[model samples]
Target: MASRKAITRSQAVKYRDASKAGKAAILDLVCAVTGFNRDYARRALRQALVPRVV
Candidate 1:
């Protein structure tokens, strides 16, 4: 199995912004970039948008 790469903070921010383009667009972008399935990409993007507690 291929190892998963960690996304940088900037990339996460990009994803969060791209989400404003709407679900279909964001899903396509995430899947194309990360090679993740629709469900996982959706969940991952959703989680990324959550504010981290320090």
Candidate 2:
């Protein structure tokens, strides 16, 4: 099993934002830190951009 490190909230947000702008490296960094599939990370970032309904 791969050990995961805790990413700072700022880092996660930055990574997500960078990904939305089509930066592939951010996806890889997210995957490495969170252990999520590449496609899943991509989709997640896209979904995250939508404003949440309160």
* C-alpha TM-scores of all predictions: 0.54, 0.58
Candidate 1: stretches off by over 4 Å: 1-21
Alpha-carbon RMSD to native, per candidate: 4.0, 5.1
Which residue pairs clash in candidate 2? Answer: none
lDDT of each: 0.62, 0.61
13-54 in candidate 1: lDDT tens per residue?
A: 666666456657757766787788978776776676678899
Candidate 2 residue lDDT tens string, 1-54: 223323423244666556345457777777787888888776665565567799
User: For model 1, what is the alpha-carbon lDDT of residue 25?
Assistant: 73
Candidate 2 versus truth, CA RMSD in Å, comes to 5.1
Candidate 1, position 32, lDDT = 83
